[model samples]
Target: MPPVWDPAEAPVGDVGAALLMVDARIKEIHEPEDESEDGAEAERGELNRLFVASAGAEGVQELLDGTCTLLYMFMQWLRRTHEHGDKDVIEYVVPPLVATLRMMPRSVRPQTVPTMVALVVAAGTQVSPNGWRSQYGDWTPEEMNALEATVFLVAEHINRIAGDHNFAVRMIAETLTRVETDGD
Candidate 1:
């Protein structure tokens, strides 16, 4: 199921109702026709692969801040380079990844949403970086440690595939020029 994330698009009338709508999206994504445990597990594995973004996002500290800045910056980059692609790529990986965001404390959920959206989008395309906004409060050290990556596994993946050694490094300029700094 596709993730319905934008609260503005919610049909509800109040903030509380909108929160319900937002939370409901997590439930909705997990409700596939097959309710077996195996089905759910498959969804989770796929979701993990999606967030990895070929970025080896498993223990790099550069993107960590009071909030998940890696996620925020990546999403900002996606909006500029692949808005429609974001829509296309996100649906397939919604279950656990969306669930992950839903699992976060409500205090920081709003701040981390773009990171979720960005990861969902970055799953398919080679969408990448540019951006400046990041939140600096309302985060736990454990949470920050849980999610951070400094290596671009995809850059190597693409380079190896394309046989263009310089292709990955060249992307930095393209991404920077197109992406905007978010969360200022």
Candidate 2:
């Protein structure tokens, strides 16, 4: 569990190394300390406090902002480092990437959904022209369509949020745009 990105310094590094660092930290965050009930309860309490403390109505927005920034950084890492429309990217990279993206709380869904949309676009390109269901044995059309709709709604919500909070939205949107345009 080495530090992925030092909060003191800006986010800058080798993309592959950064991805590995972020993956490691996510694993560490999710890992169980002890199997005992007491340990589990303690862990839950600590995580809840962290979530709540960041999510408070007053002056605690930085905590939530920091978490969102890190999540966006992970998305930027993947988009900049990985080749789009590659089979291995679809198989190996996307599953864990999606899982990590899911770690962001629902409160930040507006900020995170565009990343998810980017992932879907990348992954969708990898599926067979006939359909993804045939290529990927387990996925159903209904499920995929539902996910598409959900992502669309989330993106719309992001637009709505951006309309109100232009400053924060502009910051994140610009970073995402830069990552998409610039190569590593």
Candidate 3:
């Protein structure tokens, strides 16, 4: 994989705008195999649907690759934002990844784990040494607990949507290791 794009060097000014740019780039690279679906549906599902109509490992690889690109883009967009400040972005990012984990057969599970790791690493970088504190850094214990509950709202999301038991266990273990090790 290419070196992770550094947000400071090329900050993504607006998340949606960057994604639209990526959409165009993806189109430039990948011609859709199926044109039966209308442009609107195809446009929105471009990232996740790459594999459904194509044949062989190349198709599945493209689907996972698209998702990983999305993950990288979201993380770059999240740079320097306070914890949970990127909540909206996370909501947009995690579901597709979770769905990919559950919906794709185990054939891609090994490859997909790296994509999950990228998310964990991105979220980890968003925090301060003080840890997810508000701008003022004066949050109370209760407030801190509440924030912690939601700090990893994405993690909680995956936990609830564990459609594949073994895959889910591996993901849970990876997330725990990243959290415990301060994202290395």
Candidate 4:
């Protein structure tokens, strides 16, 4: 069973403030050791802790919902670029986004699944052009399969949430279409 979050104990405003404080502390902690390998490792650990804490806080689902909205906007941006033949946009964005997605924990991945799927769909569409393909070879078939699987898993989780069924289904379909198109 999932742990019940008590907003009475920690209100959403309090949680947001706590997250901001934690972020500030993390930055301060890492600034001095930015040049050292140990500092880098420590910074990573702090970041992981922050994310876990944020995800566990009361009203985190609301935060996730808001994040999903922002991600959707990013997806629209990607789609618009594709329609305009602006492949150069991805050259500046995809690598970092991909790296971040790859490093995310499976638990967290499910939380952001819709956003990830949207990103994949946008990327697949952009990559369909000959110029895009020449720059970044056809994405590996296995990668698309893995993303599809992830989308389904995330959809299952989102289905369990109270008000997210429609968004989940839409994201799942979008992701599946991209996976199929890329595989072809």
**What C-alpha lDDT values do all the predictions have?**
0.36, 0.38, 0.38, 0.40
Candidate 2: Cα lDDT at 12: 26
lDDT of 1 by residue, 1-184 (tens): 1222332221221222222222233234444455555666567557545644653433222222212222323334434444555553244334434555556554234455565455335433333211221223333433332232211222333334447644433454344445535423
Instruction: Residues 3-71, candidate 4: write the lDDT tens digits.
Output: 112212221222233333333433443345445456665675687467657767444443432223323
Clashes of each: 6, 0, 0, 0
| Candidate number achieving the greatest lDDT relative to the actual structure | 4
User: Which 10 successive residues of model 4 have the least lDDT summed?
Assistant: 1-10
Runs off by more than 4 Å, candidate 3: 1-71, 78-88, 110-184
Q: What is the C-alpha lDDT profile of model 3 across 1-184, one tens digit per residue?
A: 1123332322222223223334443344245556565685456457434534553454433332333333343343343332346455445554565565445343334443443434445544542212111223443433322222222333333334444323322443454467669966
Clashing pairs in 3: none
Instruction: Identify the superior model by TM-score, candidate 1 or candidate 3.
Output: 1
TM-scores for all predictions = 0.27, 0.31, 0.26, 0.31
In candidate 4, which residue ranges exceed 4 Å CA deviation? 1-33, 47-56, 86-115, 122-184
Cα error, residue 132 of model 4, in Å, equals 27
